[model samples]
Target: MNRILVIGGTGTVGRQVVSRLAATGARVRAMARNPGAARLPPQVEVVRGDLTLPETLDGCLDGIDAVFLVWTAPATAVAPALERITKHARRIVFLSAPLKTPHPLFQQPNPLRAMVEHIERLIETSGLQWTFLRPGMFAANALNWWAPQIRAGDVMRWPYLAAPTTPIDERDIAAVAVRALYEDGHDGAGYVLTGPQSLGQFEQVSAIGRVIGRSLRIEEISPDEAQRELLRIGPLVAVNMLLNAWAAAIGQPAHVTSTVAAITGAPAKTFLDWATDNAAEFRA
Candidate 1:
């Protein structure tokens, strides 16, 4: 059995990866900044590790054969962390954004993209077998974007409601990542993963409303208003990035891919599937 370490194992996608790996009867170790707070299964060994503090990763990487890296640390810490990971893990699967894709949606200025590219270069030259999972818009973003609005009422006020996106489910990303981590032939491969359908922002909201049995109202606001209101939820850069991406996506169809089905032998979950699975979050 491969002893796998999942860095950033407490995040939305990372948590799914950890659970999926554990279900496969693999020796799974989860690295978190706070081990006691990690609400994982009893079988998973949780270790305290912080990417900002590279010294903390030494213990977490011990005897770890393969690693699933979800980097949330600053770009300054990438070099030191990769050095430590390379010493222990022979293979690594990094959760990254679609930086290489030529689509305007992905080409928009994102602060995270520079950091990911830098990390990718380091991993490529580090001599460890590496695979990059570049995922598009996450379907789970609805939780943060509209769950509160839905939980309170039916009106979802937003900007660029006509913008199209694939809204890939995070589980599909994890499933592809799991195969890359333990399996062969995935080394040096970069998988561009997305949901199967190209649905507009309003259509996605309608899908959620249909799944939850509600006739929700989607009020389109200007980008300026959205920036102002969304700032309360995320950082300035993240808010601007989303607004910019959605604004650019309005006149074009979102880039969709079949990599999930190609790799996992099953189609990626639709936005409706995601909404149905998490309908409770939108309930009052």
Candidate 2:
């Protein structure tokens, strides 16, 4: 009769986590800002709540044994939300990025990183069992960057042609998150998860080519050009973060970790495999 509450449940990773947990016959409640918009399974209890307003989560946490907490709000609200979950849940599984190096972009007072780290610190002293999953760049991010180009045809322009990364499948991150939320022995642990191989931007795009049966061309543009294009497409904060990360990765070693396979008892899927599975999304 154990129930779990999932925050940001309508998001990419959260959807997968909710589905996996529901399949096990566990009572799952999905928290979202717009419950009506969440395309969750019939068994899931989709509740309307916002992380910025912790007061609204009042009855949502009732009788919930554990929480899959994704940092969705600014740093100022993290403590209150954690406290609310702590009042009812015995454990929590947090999704966060690995800390950046040199300047530590994560430590620069940014809301997301500050809140994530603060929550980890709070859980450490709150006597709540916890697990943190710090996965690398998501292969789904390629869908954000390259899917449109693939649909348009032949060419994908990108920066960091030589900057390789072990892009993890979001599903693997969810699998680990689901296990950590319901199981034991993962408490107080941080997992650095990544895909099976380190691939540069061109190689990643080419993998998409093989999957969808198209000869996708790689247009190697400068980081400056990439920045301009990204800014034109979206918000400034995300674009700057991505450009800086790519610049750092150009010279640094690509992070490849066995934590996913180690925790799941199965090898992490490759980028080619990920592209193949999601080929329909990239099709025109």
Residue-level lDDT for 240 in candidate 1: 93
In the range 67-125, model 1's lDDT, one tens digit per residue, is 99998788899999999999999999999888989998999877877888999999999
Candidate 1's TM-score: 0.98
Candidate 1: segments with Cα more than 4 A from true spot: none
lDDT digits (tens) for residues 220-282 of candidate 2: 888778878877546777777776666667755577888888888989999988999999989
Predicted structure with the largest TM-score when compared to the true one: 1
The alpha-carbon lDDT assigned to residue 186 of candidate 2 equals 97
**Relative to the unseen true structure, what is the C-alpha lDDT of residue 171 in candidate 2, on a scale of 0 to 100?**
90
Q: Between which residue pairs do clashes occur in model 2?
A: none
Model 2 misplaced stretches (Cα beyond 4 Å): 100-112
Enumerate clash totals for all models, in the order shown: 0, 0
